[model samples]
Structure formats: C-alpha cells, structure tokens
Target: MEWDWNFVRQIMPVLVQGVKITILATLLGSILAAAVGLVIALGRRSDNRIVARSIGLIAEFIRGTPLLVQLYFIFYVLPDVGILLPPLLAGVIGLGVHYGTYTAEVYRAGIDNVPRGQWEAAKACNLSSRQTWTRIILPQAIPPMIPALANYFIGMFKETPLLSAITVLELMNQAKIVANSYYRYLEPITLVGAFFLAISLIAVVLMRWLEQRYGRIEP
Candidate 1:
C-alpha cells in the first residue's frame, strides 16, 4: 500500500501524546532509580558486616530478576495485598528498582574510585562524615557516574514500552491502539520505530557529551 500522509496526520496527535508519556516515564523513573541506587550503594558499604552483606544480596537479587517480571509484580500483584499504586507510578517504581540494582554497582564503582588518601585527608581535617561525603566524596564520585547513569536512563526510556503491559499508554501502546483501530499496522508501527530511533540517537549524542564532560575515574 502507498504511504498516506492523510492517515499520518490523523494519528500524529495521539502518537505525540504517547511520546510525552514515554519521556515522562523515563524522567521520573530515572529520578527514582538514582535515589534508590545511591541508597543501596551506600547501604552495601555500611560499616556493619551484616547490613552490608544483606544490602549486597538484595541488590544482586533485584539485578538478577527481569524488569518485566518486576513490573508485573508491582502493578498487578501488589494490589492483591491492598497496596495499590497508579499505573504510571507503579511503572516508574518497577523500572527504578530493577535498574536501581544495576546503577548501584555504578555508584559503588565510582565511590570506590575515590582514593583512600582522600578519606584519610577528610578525617585528618576533622570533617564530619556528613561534610566529608557531601563536600568531598559524592561530588567527585557522582561526576564520573553520570555517563553510566545517563546510559541507564536511556535504557529505561527504551524500556518504557514495557510499561504498556500494565496499561501505561506509552508510545508503543499508543501505536498499537492506532493500528488496531484502523487495521493498518504499517504506519503506526513504523512511526513508533521512527520515534524511538530518533529519540535514542539524540540521547546517545547527549550521552557522549556527558561522557566527555565527566571524563573517567580510575577504579
């Protein structure tokens, strides 16, 4: 069949809405993931052996599980226990948590790269732990991790289509809706791919800029 501009025009608005939802899910999910990952990373480094080991095990378990399974459990299983969450919120949590485990490692690597001498110097200066981390460790640690974190954010963006399984209506879901309604799979599906490719290429370009800006840490 010939490409029809008329049909594309009809579907553009809905698809754009889907694109917005996709970006929203990624942004919110990345924010949650960054917080959770930092906590998990810090917890794994706690002075207490039991706490450290427990947190490490939990991070490994979550990282081992598939993202889709985590999403299903969050969106569907949790409601049975009366802890219901809105679809988008649930999706972001699921994405955050699952990817958070991975980002935790990124955090750990960055943190570990900070020289032991830096820690000693901070203590020598009589800097409180809070001042040490807030002023010294984190600022240095976080910059190098930005590229990896940004990569995961892009990965999460690509994975937004999985949120559709829970009825989140991201780009893929919207594309499916348009195609199903009109019985023309080609245009909508193709446009979805176009959107994903266009955005991902843009994200990669940004990621490169971030990598250059952040440089690298020696772990």
Candidate 2:
C-alpha cells in the first residue's frame, strides 16, 4: 500500500492524546513507586527482624509475579472484595506496586554502598538515627541512586502499555483502538512505534544528564 499522509494527519491527534495518557501514568506511577519503595527499603533495613523479613517477603512476592497478573487482580478481582477502584487508579497502583519492588532494591543497594565509616562517624558524633540518615547516609546514598531511579522512570514509561490490559487506554491501547476501528494497522502502529522511540530517546538523554549531575554531586 502507498504511504497515507492524509491518514497520518488524521490520527495525529489521537496519538497525541495517547502520549498524554502514557506520560501521566508514568509520572504518577513513578511517584508512587518512589514513595512506596523508600518505605520498603527502610523496612528491609530495620533492626527488627519481623519488619525486615516481612518487607523482604512482600518485595519478593511483588517482584516474582508478572505485572499483568497484578493489574488483572487489582482491576478485576478487587471489586469482588469490596475495594472497587477505577480503571486508571487500579492501573497506577498495579504499576506502582510492581515497580516499587525493583526501586526498593535500588534504594537498598544505594544505602548499602554508603561506606560503613559514615555510620560509624555518625555514631561517634552521637547523632540520632534520624539525623544520621537524613544528614549523612541519605545525602551520600541518594545521589548514587539518581541514575537508577531515572532508569526506573524510563522503564515505567514503557510499561504503561501493560495498563492497557486493564483497559486504561494508554498509548498502545489507543493505537490498537484506532487500528481496529479503521482497519488500518499500518499507520497507527507505525506511529505508535515512532512515538515510543522518540520518547525513549528523550528520556535517555535526560537520564544521562541526571547521571552526570549526580556523579558530580557524589564525587
């Protein structure tokens, strides 16, 4: 078939709307992931074995399961249990919880890499635990985490398509809808691919800039 400039122009608005949904999901999901992951990471590092072990088990469970299944469970099954959530909310929660496990590990690794002497120095100075973490450990640990966190944000962007499984109508979902309705998969699908690639390239460039900034801060 010949290239269809007219078709491309017609579908551009739909594609733009889909891109908006994708970005919204990614931003919201990343925020949730970051907040939840910090809690999980802290729990895993707790002095209490029960807290640590429980967080560890929960993180493992999340990481062990496929995100699609989690989305289905949240979107489809929860209503039966009286916790009905809207499709978009459920999608965000599912994606957030799924990626939170990964982000928890990233946080844990960063905290662990903080030199032991930092902790010792904090103790020697009689710093309270909160002071030690906020003033010393986190200051050192969080910079190293910037690059990994950026990667997770990018990963979340790609994973927004999984929300389509839950009927959230993100980028891929919109593309599929357009293709099915018009029986023209070529332009829509090609546009979707190009959109993802362009966004991903921009994300990578931003991430590299963040990595350099963080590197300088750490060094």
Query: In terms of lDDT, which candidate is strongest?
Result: 1
* Error at 137, model 1, angstroms: 0.6
lDDT of 2: 0.89
Question: Distance from true position, residue 135, model 1, in Å?
Answer: 1.0
Backbone clashes in model 1, listed as residue pairs: none
Model 1 residue runs over 4 Å out of place are 217-219
- On the 0 to 100 scale, the lDDT of residue 182 in model 1 is 93
Instruction: State which candidate has the highest TM-score.
Output: 1
lDDT (0 to 1) per candidate: 0.92, 0.89
Estimate, for each residue in 104-173, the C-alpha lDDT of model 1 and write its tens digit: 9889999999899999999999999999999999998999999999998999999999999999999999
Could you tell me every candidate's TM-score relative to the true structure?
0.97, 0.95
Candidate 2: pairs in clash: none
